[model samples]
Target: MSDILKFPKDFYFGSATSATQSEGTFEGDGKGQDIWGKWFELEPEKFYNEVGPYKTTTMYKHYKEDIQLLKQTGHNSFRTSISWARLFPEGHGEVNEKAVAYYRDYFETLRENDIEPFVNLFHFDMPAALQDIGGWENRKVVDYFKEYAKTCFELFGDVVKKWFTFNEPIVHVEMGYLHQYHYPMKVDAALAVKVGYHTALASAYAIKEFKKLKTGGKIGIVLNLSPAYPRSNNEADLKAAEIAEAFQNKSFLDPAIKGEFNPLLIELIKKHDLMPDYDEKDLDVIKENTVDFLGVNYYQPVRVKARDSVPNPDAPFLPTYYFDIYDMPGKKMNPYRGWEIYEKGIYDIALNIKNDYGNIEWMITENGMGVQDEDRFKKDGMIEDDYRIDFYKGHLKWLHKGIQEGSNCVGYQVWTPIDCWSWLNAYKNRYGLIELDLETQERTIKKSGYWFKDLHDNNGFEL
Candidate 1:
């Protein structure tokens, strides 16, 4: 390998953010309440520092200036989601003209600035009205989501060429259903399966709608693919790793790419008596509507090991029943966010997609390091985020190695270009190239922002 890692000339360098996490106008402008807004209303104390969703960077108001900042940061592409509630106030039946106009202008502004807009249909922001009817657990919500997807395509398919049906669908299932972290939090393993199944069905339905329109654009799903690494080469540990991969990665990857589910995962679900009720025809739709490309979000790897003890039948069911997360000593750590930082994991994911998934076209949709109290790193009026710059270089080096070895990965997009509100954590951990002042809505380019600009301009960085 050479000391200089050069990316393909056309490889995209950009960042991503979601509407609910960045857009601040929660109630006005004819926007209906999303689950986040509703959740904040019900339990304001649950949010970080009691700072609710309404206290975002006000992208709904500052998007024009933000676009300039994107240019300043050398972004050729950007990913953001449409607020479902803002579009269809009641999830369906009525269209908000103001919301549509706002989005149209926003996307057009991005195009005018020479920034390509990659718009995602859903980003874990379900309309509160739909949640009232059981959210993703109810099959009816799937059709509603399809209708919303169709509306977005018809409305903005001109300016937006890249579309994603969902962003991290598993998070909705695992966090919202099995883990009790998101809205309508529940711990029902059976319900989690149903939600996961319906979410995939919803993506296929949306892809079906997109294909029917012939928008001349590509549609895909953004999955947070964390490669499962076993603690040892023993058969039991290998089996545990396989199960973890099937549950965490292949659960959606198979259906979205291969147009089928992993048989092992199906057997496990059956053994646990947690199979979701589904129509045979829905499986057909999923089979026929595989994605055009894939967007991978990698932040860490899942370290797995075989269970240490016999199963307890009386315990509530969870995916961890078959294996446990291995706390491998000497592992690289990002203590600020409590996530393991394994840059080589990016290379592993790319190679897995290349060898196992037929070298399908893909990109790193979200990768970044989030730090707490970033202001403490400020020196002479700028946050010297060399840590973030180093983080990006470490991952990109391995990603470049994968590309050189025949991985079909095309681009790299960071988690975000600006500091935005995170769910639950809110602004506790900052992950952005541009620093944001929550109080004044001021934006300042951090040192990483300048470093990223050079990386993007040169199409690569030195190892």
Candidate 2:
């Protein structure tokens, strides 16, 4: 019993996937095109091997079989999103019945199998119509988003008890504005701040509207929180890391949970003369309508050292300016994907919640290693993913440690249930329990699938 790895009573175990990443038929079912659909079309060279949103695992057709695999792997819950364009073809004019029917049927299947659906409203798939209207940068998009959120609750709230406003609101802003990796990419911090502020305001409005319905469902936002680590204990390095974390993680974390913006973030915004247009009345809405829960996506921690000199004035810059990613010697790495792997990061995140963030309930919404060109593992009709299994076990150990130490973490949900398309690396990093053959739309369970079943059967895997 001492060696048994157990979670608290009713702790959840699930897997997560987004609509565009898995549900193919991007244009079928009367779905309006999203940024992914358009970007791949306008600039095919930007995508890997010219793959677009149309070619996915076809979960829209195969969810029945996929749900079976989910149950076989002992999932008590699952997370999926509603494509904004799928329901409202143009950002906010009319609802598409066909899109609703597909998701209604899809969500019902999970319930029939005793799996609770942890649904999200948006996963960065902005409708092309919205984009034409300035997307999140334009304040009008927030009202458009809130209208979409309300529709989702009215239609699917009966089944999806847990609803997330956005998968990762900060990620959308940073990648779209600061990093220039997303659609409509622009390296303008001022505009990015505007977008971030709007997304947060939209989330607050959604929670307020949700309460009016008296649906008794929980509302939350998902954030990818990578704890920042200083390369050394030096004060300059440490301060830089703190600012980096505040900008990246706490910018969303504070407002979503604590109902207030961190002062440190406010200072940076002011220093850069990038104050978002915020009405005085908006502060009350944010404070009063904080999320009931949090969904944290932890992949890897960032190790940074302070810049020796000011960043190149002419070079493209982002909030990551105060520090640079330091490649520390002897740091463990996943050789297949080239991402650093440190299990302790999970434990530290949990503790931060308990000690600094007021012990709010949270779930590990996404955690998995993405391996490039995993086709070599395809043999005997199954992808033998021993490495993936090891990755899961290692993270679980730290998560278990978090529970033992009395953090308020409630569950763990892996990055994906089946291999799907990521933002830039389309089908490059395979991080799924069920290996999907993109050609035939066939899915085969790897060894990890069976191992998870055993873990779930026993209420925990052996530590």
lDDT winner: 1
- For residues 1-463, write the lDDT of model 1, one tens digit per residue: 6577899978999999999999887456898889999999999888889888876889999999999999999999999999999999899999999999999999999999888898998998999999999999889999999999999999999889999999999899999978878998888999999999999999999999999999788999999999999999999999999999999999999999999999999999999999988879999999999999999999999999999988799987888999999999999999999999999999999999999998999999999999999989999999999999999999999999999999998899998989999999999999999999987889999999999899889998877
The residue-level lDDT of candidate 2 at 115 comes to 91
Each prediction's number of clashing residue pairs = 0, 0
lDDT of 2 by residue, 121-227 (tens): 89999999999989998989989988898888888888889999999888889889888789888888888999999989989989988988878779999999899
lDDT agreement of model 1 with the native: 0.93
**CA lDDT of every candidate:** 0.93, 0.88
The TM-score, computed over Cα atoms with residue i paired to residue i, of candidate 1 is 0.99
> What TM-score goes with each of the models?
0.99, 0.97
Error of 1 at 219 (Å): 0.3
